[model samples]
Target: MTGAMDKVGTTGGRKRRAGVVAALLCLVVAVLSSAILVSPGPAAAQQRPRTILDMLFGNGLDRGQPYRISPRYRITDPETPERRPARRTTRKAKPQNPAPKAAATAPDQTAAKPAVAAKKEDAKTILVVGDFLAASLANGLKDAYEDNPMVVVKAAANGSSGLVRQDHYDWSTQLAPLIEANDPAVLVMMIGSNDRQPFYGTDASLAVRSPEWNAEYQRRVDEIADIAAKQKVPLVWVGAPPFKFDRMSEDMVYFNDLYRQAAQRVSGEYVDVWEGFVDENDSFIYSGPSVDGQTVQLRNSDGITMTDAGNDKLAFFARKAIDRYVAADQTSEAPAPGARIDLPPIAGAATAVRSPPVSLDDPSLDGGEALLGGGSRAAGIDFEPSPRDKLVLIGRGTGHVDGRADDFAWNDKSSAVASDDKPVAFRGSIDLQKVRKEQGIKPPQEMPSILDAIMDDWSQDNSQAAGGAAQK
Candidate 1:
């Protein structure tokens, strides 16, 4: 019996030891699981790892029971269907009549305003003709009026051409057709550089400074002037500029004078480009004042053709006359955009308010009421001419006769007859007697003509040439 009790005690002790070992093993596992959960996991494992405790107690736990839910995490009672308001099924009453529909689409009757205003007036055409100089002038004028909507500049200049070269180009024949075709408001003509050469007259080939040459050249000039006059187109004739060569410059001066005379005869204005391209001493200059008053190179190395600045300056001179004659006529009190035109007020009509004129005198008139004087003379009374006012004839005979004492061929104020009763000398030093002797011609008291002056210069140049040749 004691031995049996000892065996039973041994078994009981073994069972207690096993329970204790199992309890120690569970505590060690719980500590290891808590440490693993508290510490950081492997970087590769983004998700929570399946723990041993979770696997053991996952199905056994009653986590959804009321006692298990914490006060902070507890869900409120679900909403009852009786507490919510029910939707209405019956529809509201419809209106008796619908609002009237807008009127049907119709075509617009009122005229729409123009997208862009039409031009008030056609652009005035300007026809330019001559040699290369005229071409340059045209270019400069075009640039000057580029922004102006009223001006149209046309270039019709032929290079290395002139009135003297009819075989090459006939201006008299060509100009009429050009005028008819273009119908230019203004005609600008410049020539005579190539005209320094000999010309062929109707009868024969004439010398450079001969009488026949002058007559023939004058006739050709008149023909061109007549063409412009027939069309009633205002002419602006530009004269030749002074050249670097003495002989050439002298010839140009003569040509300029002839051009001036011809222009005046035809009621045209002559533009003397000589002074503009000359120095203080009246000599050829390659550089001069431009249109903007800047000192710039004016001529090419050839000494005849013009630079851009030179061309602008040339056009500047011609532009003045163009403005006065061509553009001035178009200047009137035209109504501006949105401006009202003045008209007579009618009876029982609302009087239109208008700004008073800037000046009491009419701007269009020369002197307004001061000159009109109630449709009569303003300054003085009219003087009537009697039968004796007829022009008195200087010569007694109807045929060739000498002038009387009272007859002076020209006005007394002319410089042609000097204070000393002798003709005025030429502009610079070239003694008249010396010139006459060089040419084997007789000296005269009166001033020499353009032809005579040119002949004298040519003769002096020839003598110098002969002397230079003899010395060589």
Candidate 2:
């Protein structure tokens, strides 16, 4: 009996070890999947560098600028004559949209306020760089925004590009001039489709410099975002859209998260338009039927690049921000000449609700929104500890309830959860209901707000001491 008992104890210990091992593996996989969701594979420039998949699909942008495209008369350098921006495209008025119904006598109409000149708008221009699909967006902007004199939008797209090893040799240097010359008001960037071609070094740690896939992708986002920051240009990094991705899809996911982190670091913005096209299963099929009584073909015949309709959709959102701004005030400084859009603070913009009961087999929640006050409050992030945990600490989503208008923070990080390695603190709203739901635990209703309870008890104790002292 003693021998049998010893064996049982040993077996139980082994089982516990196995369970922990399994949990750790699951954590790693979950994080890895989430990482790949946004990042793309990499490529170095040498060949034509076009991916049939991307060619048919797209480079992930369906929106664009003030004068999205302006391939007008050839422009010569004002000083050097050799160095010029958009040599082939000078500032020229494009056609008016849905041409305003003419009542004749239109020559006198423009006398109103001396219509603004598109060329002069270049002084406050915004720059956008992306993959080939973004070319249409650039053109669309030129067509739609030629009338807005307050802003000029310039763009350059390289067909198959990576953040680290760009297939198009000229993009980096071509784009650098704008930062050097204009120091733009805003910047819109979206690239990273062909990076999955693999360019890593022998050692994992040396991947980025060595063109290793992972490091290279990070380098791309960081390098781009950092450059924009240095230029004092607000940057908006558009996330890659879903495609009929096989191997590259996973890489795209990883890169997307990196974009978000980079954006937060620089107070930039991340636009995730992946959902506008992808279906419930995350598949990319822009065919089958039509929507809006028109052909439902959202994608080009090639299956990747967007149709004209898709570009309009993407442009609509981007333009709305621009439209909203000018209306706010005449005195408000126009967006920084090269400034990226200034969006609401994203960090600490989370809810207090936690996710409800879920099965052990679920992995979907790992990369999604944290539950907050309006509904479930807590979130169980299956954390996978990294070496960074011992170095710079960080945390995930932080948010609050709706009527919290009076309680917005002095800073965005005020409501953020502390790093997993540290004790969680709170200066902003805390959703107890959300917390309980997330931890799979519940608290009794009689428990007052943690803050209220602590202060009330302390006050009572202090008052009692004062009374006793007086009596003495």
lDDT tens digits by residue: candidate 2, 1-472: 9999999999999999999999988976775565446534332212336555334443322222122134764444345644555434567887767667687745775566645544553346656678775665666555456665656677767777655555445455566676777666677777766555555345533332244556656766677777787777777777776656555666677778888889879988777767766667777768533223354666776566777666654554354333322221122456868879866432222331354465332233433344421233237533343323322344322233322433233454423332232224333487544664588443357858999999999999999999999999
Winning model by TM-score: 1
What C-alpha lDDT values do all the predictions have?
Answer: 0.73, 0.58
RMSD of each: 30.0, 40.2
Give candidate 1 regions above 4 Å deviation.
1-121, 201-204, 328-472
TM-scores of all predicted structures:
0.47, 0.40
Q: Candidate 1's residue-wise lDDT over 1-472, tens digit each?
A: 9999999999999999999999989997887676556654344233566578545543122223222245655332235444444554899887899777666655555546423322236778889999988898998888766655567788899988898889999999999889989988889998888888788658778898789888888888888888888889989998888877899999888888888887788899898877889999998999988877789999999998889998888887788667645553233556789998887542211222463444321243333325321344336543332222323434222222223343334455444443333434433475655554577543468988999999999999999999999999
Report the lDDT of model 2 for residue 275: 70
